[model samples]
Target: MNSLLIALVRALRSHCWLRLLGCAFILSSLGNGLTQVMVFGQLLRWNASPGTLTFAYMLATLPGFIGSVWGERLCRKMSPLRILILTEVFGMVALVFPLYGLLSHHIPALLVIQSAEALFSGMSYPALTLLFKRGLSAEELPAATAMETLIFSAQVLLGTGAGVLLFNVVSPLCILLLDALSFAASAILLLTTRKKFRVRDAQTMAADFPAHLPLHWKHYSPLQKRSILLLPALAAVGSPAMALLPALVQQIRPEETTGLALPLLFARSLGQLFGPLLLSADKLRQFSTSNRRILLCLVLFLGGYFLLSPLSAWPAVSLALIFSAHLASNVVFALGTFGVLQNFTSRQVATASALAWRGQVMVAGLATGAAGLLAESIGATGALYSISLASLTGVVILLWRYRT
Candidate 1:
């Protein structure tokens, strides 16, 4: 027990950027608490339809892509911190969001504000991620990740408790005001911690086109370019699944749509709580680090998808299973993608990561909208079947790649 405690302490102390990022994360956590329990819940009260809610989820990915592409260029020209601060200011204006809906009942305006929030996210993530990368030694990366995950988990736990508390009493407008203050304050804290960052490589400066590269693919790597090429498919993953819950409830139990749906979030969040522990295990480090663990995660995801498919018709049990699938997929995706990016040519990591994120967003939008259309045509069950088959097919392809 002492040895384990010492190891964690040593890992935290060793990484300078880790501490700064930790502080930043702490602030984001507090703000996120206000957003989720208050603003988002309020949106539900404001009559955000299931489809619109899916669009909001889709919007979450959009700004990040835009920011990432633009952020890279900006990161090269000035400090990423400065750009992040600009976003912080922009986000502060978002405090008026509740008013947007309150005065006019303009759901579109609320979504626009949501999109702006995402844009700020897009701008900040790639920059902030550098802190995570630089904060730990190669050997301690897992520990560093573990600490980070613990922070996020704690944040959600605290935020949820607080949100549930605050939501009952105050209007979402009050919560939005508090969220704005929290973010602005976080920005200030991050700015104060700015000395912890330094340019790590030439790539940290800007993304430039190689003179020898093809006209069509001048600014990105072949793999990265390919990832972008696959954006439509990737983004679809979340939209369908996330959006499905509303109609799933509507179909399964008409009167209790709101109440029963709570389990999906609860189950998902609970499953996620177990993720960092699994990834941080000493046993996992001994097992395999290359690609095997990630491949295993994908395989688990496929299985989970199949298990939770709507065709199973066991609502409560299937929801739990599907939540597990999501948690597992997120764990694997984080580990696999982080491993890959860490190995990327220094100049391309941010650019490639951005593109990959972009792909995720686009695919989420496409997936949700597609699920909606398909549900309209065949039903939610048919849509789930299709996605399940595709997820399994992806697993097979990944395994084949692992072999060859």
Candidate 2:
């Protein structure tokens, strides 16, 4: 842990842009985490069926995949700073509907707002990736990513705990207002620091495009391509299980929904918090030679879903499993993936990042939608087991294809 902190400090000191981006990400993550809990709670309060909630999640995330394609194109035409600022502004605007929905008590408006926010949020990834690829040295990327994971985990802890507390004490509307303000603050910080960073078009840096490969796919190597394609499968493995959490909680303790769920959220956040420590720069370099470790972490992550399904009758055990699974998954999937992408040349990183993110959200949406249907038909436990098995199959395939 101390080594992780020292590495983060060194990475931040190495780049002024990283410090600026880190500040913005902190605020953005806090808002995102809080809004996620608040929105899920509100959906439950509205008596939304599992299918409805998961469908909404699917719709909200689908646009992100499309937006990611556009983001790559935009990266070539505009500066990363401009794209970031514009998307941030759009994100703030997208929140207005939710803010109004809170006052009007309209569920549909909130759903629409979620989808709109996702659209704007998705577009920001390419620009952010470009910034990281352009600004940070190869030596700094792993530490920088670990720092990001740590900050995000901290925000998840703060946001989930505080949002629930505030909702019970005050009103959900207050939480929405706070989330909007966080976006505004993040935008202001980015705008102010815009001039301090350099923005470059990733395409301009490439010496030549390969004639044999399709133009759009020319930037990625075979391993990078495999990595991007596998992201959705990895994402699908865990998303269904997570999407069914509210249903799982309601099944175990109907009256203590928020109370019981908060612990699970905290456990997940704790996993995320400590998960990145294993991905410190030195550790990442040590592990970069093989994908075997990542595949193993994913297998454990999926195994947790199967474990969780049986332990719903025992909340304590379920929570413990959740923590362990989430911690392992975050380390292998989240930080490990970023570390792999960072190994790519600067010219390839932005496109690889965008494509990987696009695949993740797209598959996650589909997986969530499927989870809802399965939960409605076969119950939450069945859905969890089904996704876990499916994810485990994906892991086996990955292991066979990408052997150490």
Which prediction has the highest lDDT against the true structure? 2
Please list the C-alpha lDDT of all candidates, in the order they appear. 0.56, 0.70
User: How displaced is residue 106 in candidate 1, in Å?
Assistant: 2.0
Each model's RMSD to truth, in Å? 4.9, 3.1
Candidates in order, TM-scores: namely 0.77, 0.89
lDDT of 1 by residue, 84-127 (tens): 67777777777576467656877766666667766776676555
lDDT of 2 by residue, 298-347 (tens): 77776675676557678789788888888877775554456445656555
- Model 1 global lDDT (CA atoms, 0 to 1): 0.56
Error of 1 at 259 (Å): 2.6
Residue pairs in collision within model 2: none
